[model samples]
Target: MQPSTLDVTAERPTIASVVRSARPALGLYVLFQLLAFGVLWLLSWKAGVSPGRFVGAFDGNWYLSVAEHGYDQAVTVGPDGMPAENSLVFFPLTPALTALLGLFGLPLLPAALTVSLLAGCAAAWGLFLLGRDLAGPRVGILMAVLWSIGPGSAALHLAYSESLLVALVAWTLVAVARRQWPLAGVLAILTGLTRASGSALVAGVCVAAIVAIVRRQDGWRPWLGGSLAPLGLLGYLGYVAIRTGRPDGWFWLQGGWEMHFDFGRFTWIQTLEGLTSNESSWITVTALFVVLAVALQIWAWCTRLPLPWQVYNTLTVVIALCSSNYFQSRARFLLPAFVLTVPLALLLAKLPNRALAILLTTGALVGAWYGAFLMAIVHLNP
Candidate 1:
């Protein structure tokens, strides 16, 4: 006699089921990162370049110095004993981590590499958690893989804060989605301390909480989540105030670095003025892309997607546009602006597998190039 058919609907996936589903995809993601790293390394080697020499460029050196020596306001003074401005420019987190790594007997550069790589891996896991919550385990793993092997992968290899910031932002979103308000808030706060644009996370969380309250859907939990999100940001601001005798010490540092945020000013005009006639075609293309990114954010806002994602995307766009430095490369700065990715991801979810794979593969290639190029330029210039 034939056995009766088992009803699939009767069996819901447990935590174990979810993990089992995600494991293979997650493994593929790790393999992708390894492959990307190898490819980049080969490119550098083909150019007869040493990774150490390339890594020695730009903000990397300054960060290494900060790690070796704790921050000193006096360092802001020049040889003439006047405030040189650049002295007080660097943020504290990267260097602090470098110092911690020294306890393990690692040199500054190696420590930075190790930290960036670890942070990248952690970020992938966090992104997986985020995607898992919003979509399914399979999509989550795919998103993580895309992020790790994409153009942004180069940021993970450099001594920059991109990896750390990505990890913090991803985990913060994960915590928020899980309804762990305090953890979310704390992570958001740490993100703010990590980068100036990080305040966007706090604003997003607050807006989300407010929406929940307005709907009268579990007020206390959302309120608590919102309230806790800014603590890391506030703590850092407090430190700046105590140290520099101004609550807005960080803002002042930004201003000193010529990164003024003037919303009403003509961003396009300022960007054009900064470009030279002889600059590469890539520069002009990138400038136009930044302008388009700003426009996209405005369009997204008008279309009225989810309020939290809207707020997060809008704030990041505004910050990028109003930024005085590298306004032309706002696209690069806004790479971690993942709220914009939500709508895109939703759209991609409906596509055929072949189409989705093509789109993701192309994005990953571009992301890897951009991430590496950004690091290379910064290292060379700094």
Candidate 2:
């Protein structure tokens, strides 16, 4: 029987079909997350450490503190009468979601982990969409896999807020790519509320909006979305100003943690020291990651991806590298810059299936080892 041309045309794939085809990427994302999680748990147990403590330490503890007790009205003072670190430095959305889950009878730690798991999955889905739209379905799946096994992905399974921010940023970018301006703006607002990196997302949205406006496309929506984008971050900063009675209240509070943008001066100095001098293995490894991140960013730039991705990735790396935060935490700070993995994914997608499987397994195992090591052995924040 001969098929009519109209029938063939009607059978052409739709947008919904394309989206549904990304399920394997989402499935693989969940698989690697669980596998790495199990490996870390076993190693933690073998080392006489509690898995809960491993996942709930460092910034996780601060998030738990915020969940249990809301933010302090004012920053505390140290013994030297200096402003000390307080819950205000932590973003509110992660802990707020944790506390909301606690109301449903889930324990605090479990609730926090639940938020991470859900947000991580959401982030993976959005990553798949971005990669798929940018290149193809294979690139999309590979991007998800690369991100799952990327450095500092352990935080995706922990109580940290990186997953939440990544989820928002990914979907916001996806929205921008699809010209869903209002959705992009709403997600940008949420991203702003999630962390200081929200500024990067807002900047990306504004750039996309501005481009659309200049092109005379999408009319008032771009203006509306762009106008709404920064409000969440501004609102939070304004609230902090009211609380601290200073115009730079957010920046002032961040001083307690020694976190500020310094145009990469601190990073360059510390990285050079770690590479040239006697440093702990972890410190040397961190320095190597710093180098690798910069190289990857350069590679991503050469790919000449979309403007939103470029803006977001550049700002994210700049924020991570230029900050005076703990050097060991720089890799973790870059986890949200998933676009940097796109170049790697493109290269890896050319491999035959069996070879690709072996390489991916090896990468996942290394990621698992690093995750366990950081959580159980290293005393510093990841």
Candidate 3:
């Protein structure tokens, strides 16, 4: 008899296969980032400013200030007896890491950009791994590329926390899929340290744990991990409570930054206004994407997204839309809700290779154009 083509004994994929699998998507993402960088640089050069000065120009500057001088140095009181601009509202890790990079003689914006670039790459890899585990390698590859070039993806490659937050969310979900409860919870805690949005991760873990308990799981790992996941968020709140001598002090800081919890009434108005008027191109773009995201959210539910992912995505959208200010920042805020890539990835996986390549290239061009618009027109560090 001829030797069997398939061995009875199977071997797991080699590390090389894993790396090669992620490379195309990551390479595509990086290519677009470079393209955007080139366009933004040319625009900046014409405007008599170095592109380096703009990486962290908006919130990037805020993080740099937080890194260089402690939050206390940033407290200027408004006429209404509140902080006019407060650094405490921002998370600490980005600023802290940027400060460390700055100590090595790099300028703060450059250091922050370095941190963002590295984190964004990790995020792409994590998205690939998570997508592969959820569907298949094809879906995973598409998911990573789609997310890296999605609307408002400029935020992912900028000096902002969204990149790192998505990186943490992706890996935590990967750990969850592997049933590595402790690792998932630990990453969730780190996610909390990265942003207020970390609450979505904690919610996902909690929902997953509750379901596990209801199903009579074998051990306490789920509960233990769930318990561990909220510490990073609570720890920061506790610190603020101590410093300000008020139980709601951390929340007050949010108000100082003009971010108030309003149950999303204001969000609908903002969306409707933009959808109805041509007052601001950015607002119109934001409204259109939010509509697309809502459709994706519906698709996720119809496709039965796992309970944990569902919980995370639902809570993220709720938290974001309920916030009272910074309507234009909606794009930046929603970019980290990376689970929305699922439907798009599924669709893209159905395309023939050549068509997929053309579609991806077109998406990259759209991303690069929007990145330029954000840099040159919106005057915001996406």
Candidate 4:
């Protein structure tokens, strides 16, 4: 197959130019983030918990630990005798960025928070670029706005790695779509270091590169990029293997945490049960979102998304659904699949101005409340 027709053979915009063009999207993103934080603050006040504390709860604390002290030498076991929270399960890039910021004497928490906030901005900008290239400037702005109001966007404001991961994933996809092979490869490497879900990105990049090579397009650049794309993930996995003296050290670590791939069996069972059970709202809400996400994937397949985007989005949702991890966390896991929002954004863009404004505003409010509820009320990882 030939390269994507979306490939840009024109001169690339400079960083400053891209930032200048992305100002509106960035401004809207900041506003949405502030609104989300405001909702979280009010909810936290009612719940008698500090908003800052809530943002950095659960996985954020582990990220902070890795930032401050690096990974522990031995895994600690919980009272139930399972291997306790291990920083190794957490990727390295976010903590590394947080630690780099901590060098300026900021505390670990603030450093991690700062890293997330800045990365959130970059993610918004990158999403804008991706959408603009795929559709138009209006869709680009909507893409950023939609991302800012995502149900899992609470993690963006938190000391979590989602912001960094999405930023890398967005820009890498843009590079791939534009056939900037070398840049795509570099970003894919960093993305691989950001999260295990980044494997989806690595797969997308490799697929695009292979397509170009088969068609004798882009010369040897695709070969180089595809070869470099997997290094970061393999490097980390190799380190773990050497450290643990096991070929599947990463999977072993995950198994200890009760996080293993079950090919959607666990998700299917839990989702059905959660939908019918009168358990916590978290389960019901999470299950509903999972169902909606699957529906969105079906919708996306019927749309005209490019091959790489299709591959990336499908793999991301599949990974999120197929994992045996915490069921409630699956929604947050789907945060990186931004392409799934394109159809909704396109539909919103077609509405009359007033109606569109009302719809987006309503979505932002509901999404904000959902995020706050997930964190403060349900007291769960988001």
lDDT of 3 at 341: 81
Over the stretch 1-382, how does candidate 3's per-residue lDDT look in tens digits? 2121112134557889988988976887688788777877777777677777667777877788888895764345678877565677778888888999999999888898888888888888998987776667788888778877777777765688888888888888777766677888899889888898999998898777777778777378888878889998888778766666678877887767678889988778888988996598877877787788788878777764567887898888778778988776776677777778887887788889999989988887676666667677677655
Candidate 3's C-alpha runs over 4 A off are 1-14, 42-49, 74-77, 103-105
* 3 against 4, candidate with superior TM-score: 4
Q: In model 4, what are the clashing residue pairs, if there are any?
A: none
> Candidate 4: deviation at residue 211, Å?
0.3
* Model 2 Cα lDDT, one tens digit per residue, 122-166: 888888877776667787889888888877788888899998999
Ranking by TM-score: 4, 2, 3, 1
Report the C-alpha displacement of residue 302, candidate 4, in angstroms: 1.5
Residue-by-residue lDDT tens digits, candidate 1, 167-193: 888887666555566677777767876
TM-score on alpha carbons, each prediction: 0.79, 0.93, 0.90, 0.94
Question: Which residue pairs overlap in candidate 1's backbone?
Answer: 57-379, 58-382, 150-368, 151-367, 151-368, 152-367, 185-228, 185-229, 189-232, 189-233
Greater TM-score among 1 and 2 belongs to 2
The numbered model that scores best in TM-score is 4
Please give the RMSD of candidate 2 to the true structure. Answer: 5.0
> Alpha carbon lDDT of residue 25, candidate 3?
67
Clashes by residue pair, model 2 = none
Candidates in order have lDDT scores of 0.64, 0.84, 0.78, 0.85
